[model samples]
Target: MTETTDYFDALATALLKGGMAEPAVSATLADLRGYLTETGTAAHEEFGPAGEFAARLAGGAPAGEPVAEAETWKWTADIYVDRKHLNAYGDQGWEVERIDRLGRFVSRRDPEAAMCWEYRREVTGIKDRTAMTEALAPEGWEVCGQWLYFQYFKRPKAASAGPAAVIETPPEAPGRRLFLSGGYRKQLVATLVAVVLCAALTAYAVGRGANVTAILIGAAVAAPIGGLLGWYAVKRDVLTGAKES
Candidate 1:
């Protein structure tokens, strides 16, 4: 039928399949309804009523099955020093400990056995920074700015006899940061020059017997309007550059 109806139906289907906590799902839907009404989107405004109806149906439906165990896990690798051995190595030589699958640390001495206070482990497959941070907090882990040094684990090869090799995948490269293009810079400079010229013209006109106060006020007003035009020119140039790139 309508777009709003379609959206409502899709949300209902997702909730049914996902088995999300009912109260949270209901609250999220209500918030979405309010957002739609505020934004005055025709589809969302009309969809609100349909969503309410679907929400009622969902409330009575059986909860879906519990989520399956994660197929993958991620671990944070942090460097720590053994304070007990500090006197021998000046500052206790640094050691790299691997945060295990359960968010616990495992000593390199015993990779297969769980070591107390040596590592951290938690559920894995986190792609966002917030979730990753939360997972690592129980262990003395903190994000070092934007970079995260972590490891991921997957299902073990049940039949393999050899030790599991930790696979290291390179982090995704960031997009190139953009600066204002030369064309936009030129346009901005031109606009500033035009504004200055316009002010000088208005001053000269006032000096030549036009209403001085009115000329000055008019120049002040025209400067912003001229600048706005210049801003648009710069924006257009930027868009053209983006398209070319």
Candidate 2:
């Protein structure tokens, strides 16, 4: 068989294996054939390897799900840890599943990079924690994850009413004020402070001829306390911002 014929045959085999109906596969192939004939484009040049194309086409349907080309869906984990971004994805039918430790939002949809709001509050004192969560729950917000002292939540995308709803400003959360502001800058500052304190104590001990053993012990304790505080603060802020959407 010619390469073109071989390519289609492979694609046909793959489609069948991928659970596509025979009639639908035949129709798809017929349309592709006509496109190739009219454009005078080599199948490989226009469509790349047939196996790859077939696999990609099959991806839209997923296992046990029959999906139309117009309703073809894909997964995206490109969401940031924010409600606005999650909501934007929600608007388009994407759902936020979880946020990783590093604050990346994993969402599943039939689509692309999306923007939505995220709101977070640290599960600080019992009073703030209960009030914040109980308050947000009524406003279509759902908890996604809780890391350290942080509580993550997202607002689902608004339903479309004809023309896509202009993305709305994220709702305000009462406890949002508790979150530390600044992005990575806040974390960097905390880390820097820890390092500086450690270095300064070490330098002071050396210059003053202080007991090296005692100095090292002090440094070890001080550094970690500083570092942990910093780390906790950042984690708290991250979750707070993520939910604040």
lDDT of 1 by residue, 106-215 (tens): 21212222112222222223356468766666644533222123332112122232233222232222122223444445566787688778878977897789998888
Over 4 Å off, model 1 = 1-180, 235-245
Native-to-model Cα distance after best TM-score fit, residue 87 in candidate 2, in Å:
4.8
lDDT of each: 0.40, 0.56
CA shift of 226, model 2, Å:
2.1
Cα RMSD (Å) per model? 19.1, 15.6
Q: Point out the worst 10-residue segment of candidate 1 by lDDT.
A: 86-95
Candidate 2 is scored at a TM of 0.42
TM-score of 1: 0.26
* Highest TM-score against the true fold, candidate: 2
Clashes of each: 10, 25
lDDT of 1 at 45: 45
For candidate 2, lDDT tens digit of each residue in 1-245?
Answer: 39889989988987777767798689668766866765466888867787677755554444345544322222222113344444445555544454443444444333232323344434545346557777888776666644445566766343324334333342222222122225544566768876887788789879999888998888778777877786676565554444333
Candidate 2: where is the Cα deviation over 4 Å? 1-63, 67-94, 101-103, 112-140, 160-184, 200-204, 228-245
